[model samples]
Target: MFLIFDNFIFDLDGTIINSSKEVFQCFAMAFESVNYDIDKTRLNPDIIGPPLKEIIKLIAPELNDENKINLICQNFRQIYDNDENDCSELYDGILEFLKKLKKHNKKVFMATFKPMIPTIRLVNKFKLNDLFDDIYGIDKFGKHITKEEMIEDIISKYNLNREKTVMIGDAPTDVIAAKNTGIFGIGTLWGYGSDKTELKKNSNLCINNIKELDSNCEFERILK
Candidate 1:
């Protein structure tokens, strides 16, 4: 069976791009710049899915000051965005899969928890602007929204039929957001952010390889 959806929403960090190395390094450097020491274990790939502030809170639970948190996030952006070497790369077969979607006239969008500035930068760097109908971040246009809200906004703004849409990501949050928005959720096992057990439990479907999503591959039907 081929499970097909006309509208596809993707998560960026762990899904479209493998950004763990750059993200973890910058996170550590950001805390150091702020004179705060974070448990190195807390900077692991598991923390890559959430918004920056939330991740900060998780890694440094002792810091309750909002101003300090904001400062840390700013420092992180400075370090990460200024890096000349692009450490991130699209997962193997991702580019081909995206191009296949576009070739099939599928409407594709990206909804990520990362802020808008870096999101746009990465998209432009990879020359992926033409692949998606639109891209969204947690702080798009200065309005902070959760992943669920972002999905809802995309659906409403584009008048997408919920039944014909699917969200593809590597985090449990991604599956939750899609379900909350009444859409199918497909989990990718190759990404860093998710634990295989939890992701498989929450997702409508799970695939171990990016190539599993290729246009010619057999897709297990999404159970509603």
Candidate 2:
């Protein structure tokens, strides 16, 4: 049987919900609002998993004005945070897997770099608010915290056992965070970060399907 963990920390963007397209659209809208010409082709899909500040810095390095960056970021959040669900969709089997975790008495939490307001909105919109024990988003004061910091904080706040905790995410940053925070990391291939070599090198386990979270495959097991 797969090793069952007591606490599971999940990443929001590519892991739990497919919000990359919406993210890109928001960026586009933000540029339009400021009459800044944005070359849509320059926006990479891999940019979705990182913090919004990082994304802005990467995509618009020439826009050095902090005020402008904040304005764009705010505009992006405003458009994407609306009640209407645009392109966001839950990955196949995620809802069912979450239900199973809940039934198994697992403590679920979301650790995302997305701002708190929009993150909570999406969680509630997807009707997933009840499943998570706690949610960690970027600070309201615009302080950008790393995934490692967020995971460490969660561990301390919840008094979780490091030996029985796991981080589930789709990016290298997530794996790094789990490793830095002394927890097992499970990388999902179905999401945006499909680099198996990178994931296998960092994560304790890597799963292509949600059901594989409980797989008995010897190769997939994290024996610790």
Candidate 3:
């Protein structure tokens, strides 16, 4: 299964590193600092895949004011970015799997909803720069874009063959992006945002562990 694709695009937060703790903590602090009341239950790990503003809306739907939303986002960034001790850790077997892909000369890239500043910070913190061919976030500039658009940009920029490219992620958005861009999507079960039913329905293949990508592990495939 792994040999079929020459290129792999991965999601960052839920797919590669588990940043749920850091994310939730920073969001909580941000909301408190902004005097916004939120349901703590809405701050679960499932909300980690989308952009900060989207996540804020989901967690605090009552916040309809654009100015307030922007303020909260700014506060969250200040709190999260300045925290030297980010509790994000790579999922088990991820490092080894990435190395295996590199050894096989596969082209690997990252397409994360996280902004470039913190994305680069995490990549550097984890010492993953050498493993990936390139890394991308929601936007390099202030332009608003969808995850599908970001994926499409990566495909076009690299001239990746759709048939030989796969997007591996833990969220339905990731699968949807790959589908929208005409590439294969591999759903990972071990990540924070994984919804078994949603992923099983949308993904070309679903993997339980990162090691499965290197082995002939049995996977659930939904033929579209």
Candidate 4:
């Protein structure tokens, strides 16, 4: 399966690391500091994939102004930065899969809506720098950036072959981004995307588990 693609771009939060617990805590603490009330139960599963600032705005709209939103986001960053390693864990087989990709001479990269500071921090913390060729994340100020834009940046910068490059993620946006850019998208069931139906509908291939990356049937579908 990995042999077919010369280059791979991945999403950070759900696709690469299961950081939902830490993310939820960051949101909860920041929301509390801003005096905005939110339920912990409402945080997880739905709120994992989107940009932190955007999620903060949606869940606690009362933090209406940019100033207030920025304040909460800042606090969230502090909390997350304090104990990122303890909070998140890489999914099983991820390290081995990445090593395999490198061994196969495939170029790997990351494109996530997460802010750049923590994104780089996490990558460095996990010692994943050698495995990935490049990593892209939103600006520090939390400016608006789309998935398509991120993919395009990677495409323009590296001159990647769209035909041989694929965007793999846990969300439908991933598929839409790749489809818009005339490439392939592979959706994963292990991520935070609640609507698996939509992901399958938009993606070139939707795999139920990480091990399926090694499945002959799944890879054959991509070739077809």
TM-score of 1: 0.91
Model 4 spans with C-alpha error above 4 angstroms: 1-3, 61-66, 140-143, 216-224
Predicted structure 4: lDDT: 0.80
Please provide, for model 3 over 118-220, each residue's C-alpha lDDT reduced to its tens digit, 9 standing for 90 to 100.
9999999999999999888877657767778877888898898898888999988899888988998988888775357988789988888876766742222
Question: In lDDT terms, which candidate is top?
Answer: 1
Candidate 3, run of 10 with poorest lDDT: 215-224
**Consecutive 10-residue window with the lowest summed lDDT within model 4:** 215-224
What is the alpha-carbon lDDT for the whole of candidate 2? 0.81
lDDT of 1 by residue, 1-224 (tens): 47768899999988999998888888888999989877898878877787788889888889998998999989999998777786888899899888978877788999998888888889988999999999999888688888899899999999999988999999988998888999999998988754578888889998877767764332344323
- Flag regions of model 1 displaced more than 4 Å: 215-224
Those runs of model 3 whose alpha carbons end farther than 4 Å from true positions after fitting are: 1-3, 217-224
The CA lDDT of each predicted structure is 0.86, 0.81, 0.84, 0.80
Clashing pairs in 4: none
- lDDT winner between 1 and 4, please give it: 1
Candidate 1 differs from the real structure by a C-alpha RMSD in angstroms, to one decimal, of 3.4
Residue ranges of candidate 2 with Cα displaced over 4 Å: 140-142, 194-197, 216-224
Per-prediction CA RMSD (Å): 3.4, 3.6, 4.4, 3.4
Model 2 alpha-carbon miss at residue 24, Å: 1.4
